[model samples]
Target: MDIIDNLNAVKRGKLSRRAFNRSLLAAGVGLFSAPLLPRKALAAEGDHPTFFTWGGFDIGELYQPYEAANGALPNFSIFGGTEEALTKMRGGFVVDAAHPCNVGLKRWVDSGLFQPVDTSRLANWGDVMPELVAMQGNDNGAGSPWMVPFDWGGTSITYRTDIFELEGEESWDMLWDERYAGRLGSLASGGDAWWCGAIKAGVDFKDIATDMAFEKIAAELRAQRPLIRVYTDDTTTLEQALASGEMAAAMTWNSSAVLLQSEEVPVKFAKPKEGQLTWVCGIMIHKDAPNLEKTYEMIDAMLSVETGKFMINDYGYGHSNLKAFDEFDEDTLKSLGLSKNPAAILDEGHFMIPQSQDWESRMNETFELVKAGF
Candidate 1:
């Protein structure tokens, strides 16, 4: 899928806006987020195998050695949104499990779309980070773990410190500050922008269903559109924008900022006072997946500390494996925005999208309206 990776962001779909919202509504609607961990989940007896996840993740050279060590590559598919992934599963999309963020676990589990992961199968289970296990209850605790976390990262403000003087405690509010109107930047897509907006408005993203709250956030975004010069889903393009001085402030992934700064782009990723938006993406087995053992191998490959290091140092996402950060030198963790106390950062409200189709539709529509200056 060729996603927009430039300043002018555009989402391509065959369906019309009305149809898109209708499809989402029919699919159980709302954003994904971690809530009170469910005490129980359904179990499966090795039916489907293989995994699916976010684009450009858990693939490439990092896992090559793992494949050589484990044998065979796991079948994979990509999803635009967690809800979309869950929709397909509930609608009978096959596979044993799926990779979703911490925020979406509860809803996915509640949807009865997956079985608890038998952690005993994941040898790295004991070595995994507690912070990750906290949000995603293990297979043992929940009677079935909905998801196993792999990579984690913060949605932080990426700015060209050379050109922009970031004074005081930084936060998402700065992305909307009129002071930087035309110079300000953001991802035009619904997910990142919505999370940023939710945090700025002090609205908990996990529980965004009320119309009034939606409208308030709509107003906040509408107020921000004119100030936005470029809204691209491409993190690389966003980083280049800052690097080339085409734009000043940008909302970017932690890895992008770390990579940029390492190369001397004069960028700094600070967790804003209102808190930064965070996410964790992992492989999930579709309930009736065809490739079972291969899928488990893929998960095992990803859970390895060596793989975790590549994800953190090379990819820049905070690894859910607590041990991954330890693999890094002191300078590396700081450069990557890994706070000393990693658990505290995980405790920060992990942004989850609204699962309610009505609310989610409105959120997307709100973005559309704002982009259209509606």
Candidate 2:
């Protein structure tokens, strides 16, 4: 079990906090010092903040410090995408904190559902990668930070190396290969597949807002439809297909590669010549968080080096904390197809940028037509 689970045991009077903390140190959970808040000053035992985040993040490990201090885990809910989460909040689903990525930074801030975070309260704020923290529109020209980047990873092809062989330099073209027809997959969401399709179409990410770029991306994806066996947002389903040799390859993120390898599957995550699709996901406090102090503590816990290490080592993603890089050697990171420097991916890959919501609607509608063999 992770730290938060152990802390829950302590809260139930089944374990001691001191003993659990010692075990955490023994397991190398704390790479940077985060002094524990006095238990007496923490929120009341029954007062827990609510977190609205991605599916896999509603776990104990990410919020260990808060659970230990407050003696209860934060109430949690999961959203499949940031856009869906935003719509839910707009419809009156109140949460203390929500997870969004750099691509959604502008839209999330513009919604006015969130307030700027006081970095001073975040003990690990200084260690956050500036490239991630300074995403477009996040600085707001008023010295306030709008989002706190926590996790980052790449969107690229994961292929069965034992079954698939490239004829030339690795590129996104593999997804369009006729040889893999009826044996390949791609994400169903336009938010991801559209950008990746743009990369394959040779459209510069910066020009994605233009009509010419949209036409190019749409044409490329339409051409690619005959080759794809399925389209889904579920990475696990894709991973299972690749592992069972049912799929030769699929559009996937870094985690698929890590999870597949651990299960002893012969797979490789491509670093395509066209560039990988890189993204950064982070946390934002609701404008009217009912439990503001608990929410602040939860965000700080997520930014801690401990959580950063878990994110990188366990989930196969880059952490926002600089100290997390210190835990792994350059060789180790390279073996996992990651760079010790997040800038390598952010600067070199096809990092996503915010687009008008109307663009997203149009792209999704167009993609649906393509998927239906238009």
Candidate 3:
């Protein structure tokens, strides 16, 4: 297959990102020439709203309706993690909208960097799941929400079924097993890892902000630190390691396991007996969105069923629009670790509770110190 075909395959989960890169190198493609791969023409910079989001969410599949109406996709900016994105925005970087999960909702709102979204402006607003829209700190008390919910999913262990020997039922302890020490990986972001640490530490989310909870979670993470072969925010690194058998397992989002399985890799997204760390992520309009009208169009397009179907089928994430689940049967949703009734999966998992900016800062700082071998 040609480069364009390989790129499409990677997007569709048919080809691994590592294999796609290998093919590019074997074909004598250079870093500069990589951009020459066939893609829809985009309007000149600044002609459309800029979407600041996680790396993978910037693709065309999620913006079909907006592209159809505007004849080009929005200008895109990618962040490795939400914390990094928030830090940049707080440093005076401006964008039309940004993607952040429910756990950070209160902190984001308290930052005073975003504005309430007028649901009436979005065409798909009514179909958006009420559960997601009603997340803590989402309501502005004016019938508008500070953030419009988009994707929701769990963070858990993605392990090699063929290589990793199971001694018991799946649990968070798999990540801490001494047998797999130095053969495991983890996401570097505390937003995910620290919460999973809370789970493994048996600290309730409601008391996560307490001093005792902080010490317990930090101790758990410090214990896992020596076992981890690598700590990175890049899912590609973890996926590549698992695919090559360099690592037995890694903490990853649903997409990692789904992508590996599509390539026939013997991997499974573990349903820990302790429950997975669940979260809801969505977009918030910047307080100074230069393209307010187009921003609404971007949010509406993301809430469309087409985007939702692609998210579920390709990435194994739950879409906020309830109608998005209509295209998938119960069996398919079950296999993907999802459900038509989101509450079925969401309520069962250890959902993250929003904490204040002070707690978030302190937790992240402590986690960083632990990861640094302090």
Candidate 4:
């Protein structure tokens, strides 16, 4: 179980908050040195407030627009996981906001760890997409809403078309093909690898707790490890490897595939017959979040179609803004593989991480099994 789940259990009389927080710190996600008393913090007096999140997650694309519109640059501290992001927020720290994903949405909201964003304060809410707003959880009509869906994409295989003889054919079985031996790469994260393994084994994502199922995934991974160049989370590194011919294929974000195809890397994003894994990382306003007003403004700026166009033009994933799909002409869309019928494969994709603690623990253990080659 994660810290937030434990805290919820404490709220419902299953565990004590002291115990939860103690266990949380022991997990090495974060630590809060404080008197055991709860003290609520008021908003800080400032025009522009600091922003903190994982370095690559927040920067790179929208930095300039956000900074210019808000009159201050974001002050960032990279959190390695959603668990770590929550650990820092539990202490009422200073950053105005933090970014997590839709999977962690319910847990963050249930903890009272964040405030609902005021809709009226946002000029771009209407300009933003509907599904993205609905994803924010619930609307209270006035306060700060929970997390907002930011960038999104599928966890898919980007294979060299030259390696596969069949054209326009995509399937999970392609990765296990021996043609790319010593030239394939997979993400090192437990969450990503587990999802891929589950998909490959034909186990229904929600029904993935059985030992037989996970064992199959681990076995498959262990079998592939010898052929894998290395496990990495950095897509840029993967791109370099692919370009340099160090790896002929990689399991990467669909956007990475888009970037590669744009550069004419002989790569194509594929949704294998076994399906694909998708994810939408989110941005949420932390309760007692620093720079409450500025945080909303930044989010509003990001919600614009103009900004969405920039993201789609640069990244391969479908935009959080609905209108982004129409931003490009047919030829451009085909060139970038953006013309895909996303739903045809979405029914086959896996879910984000489980919100329950028991499931997360089991997932971590199952992941260890794969990593250790058990």
Say which candidate scores most in TM-score.
3
lDDT of 2 at 159: 93
Mind giving the per-residue lDDT tens digits that candidate 4 earns over 1-374? 57667656765777653465446434633222121222222122356555556544344245446556645455566677776777677775656777777666766777676777766877666645554556445454564456666677688888777765544567776667676777888887766877787787777765676678767777777777667777877666776666555677888887667655544557788867666787777677777765677777777666666667766665655656666667788677666555534333334566564455555567778666656666
Which RMSD values do the candidates have, in order?
11.6, 7.9, 3.9, 14.3
Query: Which residue runs of candidate 1 sit more than 4 Å off their true CA positions?
Result: 1-49, 83-93, 136-142, 205-207, 348-358
Worst 10 residues of 2 by lDDT: 30-39
For residue 310, what is the lDDT in candidate 3? 87
- Candidate 4 lands at a TM-score of 0.76
TM-score of 2: 0.87
TM per prediction: 0.78, 0.87, 0.90, 0.76
Ranking by TM-score: 3, 2, 1, 4
Candidate 2 vs. truth: CA RMSD? 7.9
When sorted by lDDT, best at the front, the candidate numbers are 3, 2, 1, 4
Candidates' C-alpha lDDT: 0.65, 0.81, 0.86, 0.64
* Between candidates 3 and 4, the TM-score winner: 3
Least lDDT summed over 10 consecutive residues: which range in candidate 4?
A: 33-42
Candidate 3 lDDT at 266 equals: 82
User: Compared with the true structure, what per-residue lDDT tens digits does model 1 show for residues 58-130?
Assistant: 2543455445854544555667677788788777677655777765665665675565566778877887776
Of the two candidates 1 and 3, the one with more favorable TM-score, higher being better, is 3
In model 3, the clashing pairs are none
